[model samples]
Target chain A: MPEMTYAQAIDHALGQAMAEDPRIVVFGEDVVMLRRELYVRFGPRRVRQTPISEAAFLAMGVGAAMAGLRPVVEIMMVDFIAVAFDALLNQATKIRAFSGGKWNVPLVVRTSCGGGYGDGGQHEQCLWGLISSMPGVSVAVPSNPQDAASLMISCLQSEDPVVFMEHKLLSDYWRDYLGGGSRKTVAFDVPENGRIGKVEIPVKPFPPGKGKVVRKGEDLTMFSLGVGVHRCLEAAERLEEKGIQAEVVDLRWASPLDRELITSSAERTGRVLVVDEDYSAYGLSGEIAAVLAENGLRPAFGRLGTEGVIPYDVRREAKVLPNAARIEQAALTLASV
Target chain B: MRMSAETVPVEELYRQMCRAREFEMALARLWEKGLISGEMHLGIGEEAVAAGVVAHLREGDAICLDHRSTPPLVARGVDLEALVLEMLGDPEGLCCGWGGHMHLFSREHLACSSGIVGSSAPLGLGFALASQYLETGGVAVAFFGEGAMNQGMLLESLNLAAAWRLPLVLVCKDNRWAITTRSRTVTAGNLARRARSLGVPARRVDGTRVDRVWRAARWAVERARRGRGPSFLLAHCPRREGHFLGDPMLRVYRDPLGQVLEIAPPLLRSLLARPLSRLASRVRCLGQIGATLGALGLELLLEADPLERSGRLLEPSMRARVEEEARREVEEKVMRAMERRVSRA
Candidate 1:
């Protein structure tokens, strides 16, 4: 097994897919810098760079997808999606349903989201809620390198649009994007050399929302997304020390959530706590509550997320974003033990 | 300028324009019968632009159209029956009832349409980018309205196409109206100049003349095929039936007396109840109605409809024959679509 950083896993996935498929093209602002080897391997046309035109390039990806080319576009920052949302919310999401399946938009949008290195509100955001609310988009938030690699492969093979979100803290490129070091401790351990992490969750193609229980217990279930899953794991370990057992489920795929996994997990423990970095208002936590309620599950439920606007100060950002202590506290409150 | 009729055969173009015209007229009739729901946009006037550009498209060429998409789709030889069924929301239709007339897709022709304005340019860029990378030797043509040229994405597409040297042709059918607003009132500068500034060779043509549009489209399409980047063409046509099939102002044109009687009483009442300072504005409203009615009357006096202009290019007897054939084909498709609906029901 090859050890991998989250970014290397993504690069490996791109190289593997492009090796097998001639239709894959990667492009965005400074994407060549991140996937430099891909640029060397796939040549300029396949790994092209574009002007700072998010809306046009994204829409072009949609058109390219319809033209039978699978374009994996990078959107520099998830905050930049604001300028290109018409492409995402309307064109990319509506084309399949509008074309009545006559067209399959195999467009994968790779973007970096999450905050820890003091990139303000504009630079850091987990807008999965905005996209997951739509009908025809699949969102994959990989918490570890292996999950990122597997999810990238699944997204590339999907017949529709998939949004692959990488947390800035975990992506290998973060070390170079700014002077910040890669948060290897924030993710699960990868093998020593080849960049493959230990977490191996099979991602169902397209609308993948399967949850992987990284740590199992019988007391209470804690669900989280992306980097927050690691926080949940740390919290679960602490909870175990205090004689409180916690099951940690990493909700890898955001949209079309695995209802069966969520319901059964909640039913088994009779208690549910959703910990995430996305804003709590109309976000992932709220969505999980709705899903559980829709499934008729009446468990003791608690949720924690960014309190409000993410600040520029590192300490204040930490206060707003979830940490292991907050997760443990939220879990203990829910456990009432 | 040399007449395309002198240099080329245009009976085929005339026929193409006729089919597009007739096909849309049939769609308008269907909308009138309430068989198709939602706001129906009919490409009743821009037949020349569609026929002219589509005539140059060959195997592997791709197209993306605006909301008024039937003209190009008809010219491209897409299954008319499938379009009709799709418009009628039949599951067996082209898009299985998911895509309505505004959101049509034809896999066989590699054609697509979107309700979003200015989308065709980006789509064309994408398709052309694919053609460039795959070496498919296919040219991607985008059909949009002049209103779309104002959008940032279209300009961005122009810039990208130039930078990438993608094989793309951008055709803007200038109907002089963005929905109900006059295009020039909201638009600034020249459209062709803007494209040219972005390094795209652009031309403006009289869109009602199929031969003129045909020649312009030929030059642009050829340039694209030669890998000379994109060309922007502005075809000044008219939305002969107005913005959509049932345009509110279209009623004012169709039934002036009835519309004035229905609207004026309230308008006059509000005017009298309002401050005298608003008298000029109130009177301008009535004048605008009269202007719309007068414009309709004026349009009837002129041979401005593209289909009629193109039909004149062929011999009268040949013109009649082509029109009859197109009419019969549209009727057959309409009947087939109806039968599909009945069987499904």
Candidate 2:
């Protein structure tokens, strides 16, 4: 079995996809550096670099997709997608729908998101809620390296536009914080003729809109995605020490939410806690709570996420964004209720 | 295919312009009758720019249009009946009624339009980039107004097209007004200068003169096809109508009913013209009468077959037959589409 970091997994997935399909082209600011080896391998034609023109390039991706090629546009930071909102929301998301399904935008906007290094309000934001709110586009948020690779492949293969979010915290730079570089790599079963060789590490097939219960228990179900999934697992472990058996469901994709999985989990546990890295109000947490309520499931619900402002300081962000301590406390409170 | 100014066809250009004009006038009439809902930005006076530039494009070439998009779509050879049905929110519209007049798209025609300003530039750049990547020899044309000159995205698109040497042509319809505010008041420097600053070749043409526009577009399209990067065209023209139909200013300047009455038979014109003026000022009773008369007159004009009305442009004997054939073809297509909608419903 081969061990690969989260960044490596994404690179591998992109390389494999490009190798299989000549139509796929990747372009973004600084993508040449992020995927330097792929650039060298694919050359300037397939893997191109663009000037700092997010709106133009992003819309270009939409145009390219409509014309005939599949384009993977990388927005260096998720928050910067705001600049390309017209392209993403108005153009890419609505093109197929607006065109009466006459045009399909096979575009994948892969962006790195999340707050941990105090990268202020402008740089760090888990905007899955915002992107998922759009009807036409699919939103994919992967928790681990294996899911990242699989989901990236899925996004590339999708006929419609997809926003693939990568949390900065899951990158190799924070490997030390994730347990002193001792992170376990899970590899998925690759197809026989897959471009990349089969590895020993286990891989999970991240089908769009399906979630997995990472740690199952009966006391309560903690719903989270991306980096929050890891935090929820840690919180569940802490709860286990205190005789509380918490179940953590990693919601891989946020848009076509795993309603049945959440509903069954909520019904069995009767207590739901949604810990999100995005804002609490009008975000994924509220959405999950609404889903449970709408399904006529009266579970004891508690939500924890960033409240109002995303702070620039690392300490404040840690306090604002959901951590294991907060998730544990929120879960315990929900269980008591 | 490189087209020189001498090779630009006048008859075809005239036909395209007439189609755009008649289509828009029909839509305006529909609006007046309360058959169409929502905003419609008609390109009544800007038909030349659309006809001229679109004539230079082939089937594979792409075009992205702005809100005042009807002219270009019509010029690009989109199904006329489909366009009207789309505007009417019919299910068989080009966009299946999902997108109204502003958001019309026809992949078969390689044409798309959106309500958002400054969007066409980037979108067109994408099409051009695809052409460059695929080596398809197709050029993408972006049609915008002077109002979009300041948009960061438009400027960025210009820069990118130049940087990558993508086959793109940016045609700016400088109608001197961006929805009532004179464009010059908000815009600084020259419109073409903005593109030239980004290392893109640019030219300004008289948008009202179809010949001039055709020649300029032909030159730009040739440059792009030859892989010389993007070219910016500033089309200076007039907005003969208000931003939308039923604009008070439009009526003040050019009243359809008034024009019809002016061109009416001698006795009817004299009698109606004098009384209509007296009645128009009475403010109460006469105002209502004037409104009814205007509506009635416009309806009568719409009923008078477009073929008969097109006699002004075509040879009187040949005009009626040609118009009848054209109208029947369009009507039959529209009827089939409507029947399909009914069957589906």
Candidate 3:
């Protein structure tokens, strides 16, 4: 078994999918910079560069999908998708449904989301709520390199449109921030050479709309996705040290939510803590709470997420985004309730 | 300059225009009767543009229409019954009632329409790019109004289509109005020149003249099919009717009754005749009677007789027969769909 970084895992998945399917084409602003090797390997036709026209290129992806070609379009930041909201919200998401399921828009919009590196308000946002709230589109928020690879593959294979979200801080540049030094590695079953090391991440068959219980416990169930999952895991470890055992569930996809897994977990634990990096108001955290309530699960519920507008300063951002300490605190409060 | 009828089939063009005109007139009647709900943007006078441009498109070719989508859908061979059912919120609609008049779509016809302004351009570009990649020799046509020229997305789509040399044709129906605001008030410079600056071949045509629109669209579509790139066409036509039926502003149209009389023949107008004495008896209030008389007069004059006129241009008996058949088909289908909805309930 070898270890791979999150960035490398995404690149590996894209390369493999593009190689296997001739219909796949990747295009976006500065995608060549991120996946240059794939560009050289697949040539310009498959891996192309696009202008800064988010609306046009994103819609081109939708049109391309309607024309029987699979397109993987990348928007540099999640916030920028707002510029192309007409295309993403009105066109890509509703094409199939509007066409009465006769038209399948098989496209993936890969965007970098979340904050921690002081990227400021415009660049850093976890808008999973916006995408997941809309029907006819699926959203994937991978927590680790292994999940990232499998989730990307699942998104590529889906018959509908998908918004695949990647957290900026979880990429290769944030390995140190992940508390993993240069030699640190996470072991997996599959072995492949990544930019950092032999890319070995346990290739699990994690289907879309499914949740994975990373840790099992009876005291409380913590639900998180994307980079917040890492924070939840660390918080769970810290909680164990204080004699509190917390179960952590990684919700991979937001839409077609894993209701069974989440409800069963809450039933077993009798308490729920939702940790999210997005804004607390009308966001993923509230959505999870609503889902739990709608399912008639009356567990003691608490939520930990950013309060308002994200700040640019590092110290302020740390307070705005959910951290391990905050998660633990929220969990303790829910347990007490 | 007057367009040559030899350039395209004038009779077929007339028939297509009549189809669009009659469909919209039917929609207006339905809307007036409170059967069809929601907003409807009628393309009563802009029929030539849709009929002409769609005449040159192949089955594999795609089209994205804007809010005033009835003309294009009718011209693109969409089933009138399905379209009406969709507008009526029937479950057996083209989109199973999820998408209304504005968001109607059909993959089989490779046609879609959006209520959002300036959305069709980018979506059409996508279709063109896919056709280019598949080497399918299909061109994507985007139908918008003069109002959409300023939209950043539409401009971006123009740039992208030109940059990639995608087989795209952008048709701007310059009706001079964008929902009451004159387009010229907001638009600066020339729209055709704007596309030309983006490296696309663009031309303006007389939108009322189907022959002229057909020539312009043919040149653009051929250029795209030959892999030359995108083309922009500005079809300068008239709105002819209000932005929507029953629009209060249309009361200001000069000789509105006279214009309506021109479209509806004397026979149909007589068929809708009602005694003023009976009308007064039904209405107790003078103001209500006045409003009722005005509405009835307009309804009698706007009875979609232009379709009969256009059909008579080819063969009067054949046209009447076709319309009768279509009326029966629409009525039967609508009844069946309504029954299904009731049973499900």
Candidate 4:
């Protein structure tokens, strides 16, 4: 087992998937060079470089799928998806159904997303929310390396189009954390059998559609996802000294919510505090609160929505997004009020 | 009038033109009777180009169709009844009533007919990319009107297809008119020359004659399939009908009514004024147009069987099936979205 960061974990997963399927292609702006140098062992065809035409390239991937090839087309930045939305939402996603199920578009589209990066508004927008709203698309935002690899492999194997969103910050920061603290750092490790390594399991799947308890507490249930989950966990750890036993839960899947798990947890804890980085209204937290209200868990929704009309300026964004301090305050408030 | 698998004859080309004209007339009738909805752009005099280009294509090759490509899709083996029913908004239509006439799709024939004006250009390039990636001996063709040359998507596609050396054929069916604007009035320079500037082999074909179009298209298709990269063909045809039914051509063009009136004199008087050569030319043109329409009528009769029968075309059971499919698709989309949100969150 080994301890690896989230980014390193993603690299490991990408390497593993590439090694498994020759049909799987990794392509984007600097992907051909970066992916090859990172993997060093793979050919230039499987890992290709492309000119900056996102729509056309994405369409090329779609066309490639119709002719029986699995492709992983990367949009270097998620913001570029705006230029290729037509191909992504119309051509690739609708090919199978449009053709009466004659062909499946088995392709993976990867992009780096989120607002923590100093790249400012254009580069750091977490637009997965908009993509998630589209049909015939599978969107994955892996916070850790284990998920990055597993989810990517699953996407590569699936017969549908998947939008894999990798957080640039995590890729740059979390390689060792994904290693699971292993003595030997092999090229990559799959979590199976005796191959278990030394990585902290911050949270695991407790119940479907429900948040998992990172810590058992009689006080408040702090619900969050993505980086918010990490922040909430940090807050829970700090609050342990104040004797405010905070039970932090990671709301993994956002769309086909594990409604049962969330509601049951809320009912068990009686008091609920939802946290998120996206804005307040219509965000995941609001949806969760609505779901709870409809299902009998009237928990307090303490959403620490980022404060900004626009998403430019990294310093301002940092001040806006839900951080450890905000999470701790929200948790304390839920526990007391 | 010679014909082969690789080439269409003049007489056959005439027949295709007639078919396009009659089919549009029939479609207009359907629309008037409230049997069809949405909008349609007819390809009447452009029949020679559609038949010519498509004749050179094989089973494995794919063609991207614009809004004005009904006859090509039909000739390529799309079911006429399904096409008609789709226009009628029936659930059993090609897109299960999701796409109307302009968005006809036939998987069995590998034809993708779309409504978006310049969308096919990129998709066709995609097919070329697919062919190159898979090492398949197949070519992808794009049938765009002259007006579409201005679209950024098509222009970009040209560069990409050439850069990748993809096996693509870009057929610019310059049917003289894009809606109301004549190609001469809107486009700059020559179509083939524009393609040549992009490093693609370009050719000009007499789109009024089927055999001429067929020969040029065949050569381009073969060249592409053999990995010679992309080709562009400018097919110069004409527009006999208005952009759509009820859209009188007189308003768009200068004095179409006056020209029709001028030509409405006694046949004998005109013949006497022109002598034997002039009379012969007039007779031949009229005969060609008539023969074309007759052939179209026959083809429709033969091809329109499935959509005609009252007991089967849109049976209650069929409607139910379509509903079930739509519901299934919607639910699947919703569930998948939910799943992604859950897992990603």
Candidate 5:
């Protein structure tokens, strides 16, 4: 067992995968901060730098993947993915199906996302929902370091295109970078857990299409992903103080959602609360609600999420985003209902 | 591979161009018959450029094409029947009927085309980037219109290719019109200068002439194969069918007098509004109509079809035979494509 930050884990997994496979090549703007060690180690050919052209670079990743090269392309920010959306949605995702399975884009688009950092509306979006909604491609959103590394490895090894979303709050370096007005310090598996603070890498993969119930409970089921997983745990702790017995489940992947786990969990509790860091409308929250409805579970449902915008002011952002307090309050309402 | 470029077989290149032209002609017939859905874009006049450059391609070479992709795809030896079936929205077609003419792709040939105007550059650069890593010693060539050069991705691709020294040949078929708008008016600065600024060697050639396009493409592809980075080729050609099938402008090309009569009433109505006071304005308005006709005249003046132009390079008897063979081949493809099938594309 080893301890590493979420970003460090991404680096470790990508490095390991690249070491195992020479076909893998990394490219992005300045090779992305999360993959600095990769640039130093893999050098120019493997870990390449690019001009700030999201469309070209992203499509290049698609082309490379088609030509038998595993390319991990960093689009810099999840918001920046809009610039590369055409490449991702039209080219990367549809290449395999369009070419009659003759061409598969084994690409990993690593983009940093999520809000509560006060970077304003443009930069602070967690729009994995838009990507996940697309027919082809898999989206992996890791909640902790171990999952980040494990999922990163899986994304690299996938025979198809995958988008690896790195939440800003989950990254250790990003936390230090945006430390100015960040009120809530989210420490998910840190100094408190002696095992998590170790230098060795943990490659224990929970695997894709599986959700992990971090804190098991019986009263109510709380669904979350990315930074919201930590928020859900915090809310669960407070819910426990009031004897609510809220279960916290970390949904690591956005697309190809763990419907089996989600439906089973909802079936057990018969009540669900979806707390998401992204906007609730057509988001992961709505998706979970739809999944539940499709599976014939119409329990006491409640969802807490951003109102489609991440404000520039830190206080306003924290207030807008799904925090532990909001999650707890939402849970209380759902429990009462 | 270089020998393919050096010899410049006139009859062989002519046959390729003829095959592309006849294929598009058959596609046009299908479109006219209301078989193909959506906007039909034919690379009717760009046969020489496609045949010229595609002639130099080896087994490992890749191609990325723009909306009017039939020329390159035909030159690349993609199944003509499959192409026709794909256009007809048949399951046993290229791309399994998922992609139309513009978005056609073939993994076997390492060829792809997109309806997105400027996407060819990025997609082609991706192939070039892979070839660099694969060490296949193969070069990638992208065929796009001059209009696509304005797109951010194409510009970025040029910079990336030049900076990384990826084996890429950016072939810009400068039809001089971006859809309906004259390219020179909207297109800022010189195109060759734009490529030169990006550290790429650029050359402009007569796109109607296969010999010229062949030489230019051969030189550029060789430069890329040598690991010297990307090269830009501006092949100035004509779009025989303007922009797309069923373009309103096509009506203007056919029965110009009727079109003028259909069009002149609006201008004539303005003249009748104020007979004397708005005289100067009326003259200026007439000048506008005259300019449109002048543009049409300009289009007619450059009416040298690439297939016909290249065919003349061969002996008259041999050229006639080649043209007949190409026509028969395309006819057989159209017949096969029309027959129902439940097999893979």
Candidate 6:
């Protein structure tokens, strides 16, 4: 085990995967230099650089995938994918279905997502929702370094196309694992069916279909994902001393919603609050609310999310995202009611 | 193959144009009958370029065609029935009914065609890059119209291909019309000159003559395969029909036939007199069709009844089975194609 930043973990996984399989090639704009310097001390053959043509480079990745290569191609920013959409949506997505499951495109397109860089609209966007909606593509947005490593490795092993969504915000966040005596890194074997490791944090047994309760509570169930999970936990701790217990659930994976945990928690408290950074309409929280309603479970409190697109203003974005104070307030109001 | 060669018979070239013309007419009828769903962008007058360029390609060489490259695609060995099936949204189509006629690719034929303009050039470079990076001795040809010359992405591809010295042949069929816009109106100067400025040797040829295009394509493809770099072949031709099947283009551009009649009356008169020699023309057309079918080692659908149940070669049950079974078949074909490509390494 080793202490690794979120960005370092990504480098470890890419380095490990490429070493394990020669067929695996990594390429993107400045990825070769950045990954090599920041994370892995590897050669150019494994981590290749590409020209600024996103469409061409992406299609090259697609061609490489079709040619039996496990390619982890990076799109420097999530927004840039719109330029290479023809290759992504038209070519890579449909290769398997169009070929009737005959071809397996083991392609992992890694890119930095989310806001926090103050890079404006062009550089910051959580396109995970849009990408997850596309068929024949598996979207994974890891909240921390451990999940990033786990997901990147899993993406390389999967037969289908995977969008390994690495957020720019959590890149420098620190975490630890015991070092494997590996100052001089060597290739490690990968499991046939990729591995996904969960971090316990202040919670436990973080599994799909089951959300961990960060703080045991009976007042309200605070459901959130990614960075929102951390905020909800902070809010829950603050509300605990005020005699309002808010159970916090961190949804590690978004697509395969943890309905059982959500419904049971809603049933226990009779009140639920869903918080997300994206806009309220057509957001993940709306879908979760719809699911609970469909399952005959309604909470006293509803979704807390931005009404529209996140404004470029840093202050506005922070206000739009449900914070610890907002979550605590929402939970206490539901408890009193 | 010479830098200039007149290998195709002018009469045969005219017949190929007529085939494209008649095929488009059939497509129009099919659309009206509600058999075809999507907008059909036909390649009526661009028969010579397709015939010439495709005639130069070997079995393993690949081509990336644009929306209006139907004539070239057909010339490259895609079945008319399959193409029509695609237009009809049948499962037996090229993309298993997933991508109507607009997005068509056949691994067996080693060609990929798409509907998006300016995008195919980059994809073509990808195939060429794949060949070079993987060390496959194959050339990738991008068949684009003059209209695509102004596209930024295509220009980017030109720069990339030039920089990397990739094995790519960028064929620009200058028919002078992109949808409704004239090439002269959009392009700054000669398209060949544009390619030449990119530091690659380019030539302009008479696209009406299949042989000239073939000769030029041969030289370009050879240079690319040898890793000398990319070259552009600008085939100068004329539009003989509307931009697409439904486009009433006569309302826009002045009909060239009227102008040709005024300037080159004897040449126009000779072309007009061609139909009067009907019996000889019919025999020659039949012979050519026979030769083409023979070359492909396939029997003419007209010659033998390949089925016992009906006038069609395929029985209704079999056709239904083909439609039902096509999804799996396409998948298997793509997988096999991928595997075969991998084995080549």
Docking quality category of candidate 4 according to DockQ thresholds: incorrect
Q: Give the C-alpha lDDT of model 6.
A: 0.62
Candidate 1: tens digits of C-alpha lDDT, residues A79-196: 7677689988999999888887887789999998887654445456788887888889999998888878888998999889999998877764452232122112222222222223
The lDDT values for all models are 0.78, 0.74, 0.74, 0.62, 0.77, 0.62
Kindly list the per-residue Cα lDDT of model 5 for residues B81-192, writing each as its tens digit: 8888777666667866556666788999999886566778988899999999999999999999987887787998999999999999999998876654466645679999
Error of 5 at A231 (Å): 43
Model 1: residue A271 alpha-carbon error in angstroms: 18
Q: For candidate 2, please provide the TM-score of chain A on its own.
A: 0.91
Candidate 4 reaches a DockQ of 0.01
Model 4 chain A worst lDDT run, 10 consecutive residues: A174-183
- Candidate 2 per-residue lDDT, tens place, B28-126, comes to 765554445434578877877898899999978999998889888887888887877676556667776556666778988788876666889999999
List candidate 1 segments past 4 Å from native: A1-337, B1-7, B269-303
Best by lDDT: 1
Candidate 6 lDDT, B1-345, residue by residue in tens:
233223444334333443444455555555545444434566655666776677667776788988775677766767655665555444555655445555667888778876555667888899888889888788888988786777668888888889889888898877666553444533576777778888768988877655566567778888987899899888866554444433323312243464334324322232233224344443443343234323223211222211111112234565445434433443444345434434543
Number of residue pairs clashing in candidate 6, backbone atoms closer than 3 angstroms, sequence gap of 3 or more or interchain: 6
DockQ for each of the predicted structures, in order?
0.01, 0.01, 0.01, 0.01, 0.02, 0.01
**Complex DockQ, candidate 1:** 0.01
| C-alpha lDDT (0 to 100) for residue A123 of candidate 4 | 43
lDDT of 5 by residue, A90-195 (tens): 8888988898988788989998887654445656778888789998988998887777888888787788889999877667555434322112322222222211
User: Which of the numbered candidates is closest to the native, going by highest TM-score?
Assistant: 1
All predictions: root-mean-square deviation over Cα?
A: 21.7, 24.2, 24.0, 25.5, 21.6, 25.3
In model 6, pairs of residues that clash are: A1-A177, A1-A178, A1-A179, A2-A177, A2-A178, A99-B331
Candidate 4 residue A173 C-alpha distance from true site, Å: 8.0
Q: Candidate 4 regions off by >4 Å?
A: A95-103, A173-213, A307-314, B1-345
TM-score of structure candidate 4 = 0.45
Give the per-residue lDDT of model 3 (tens digit) for A59-178: 999999999999999887788788788777899888888888888899899998877644345556788887787878899998777778888889999999999988776775332221
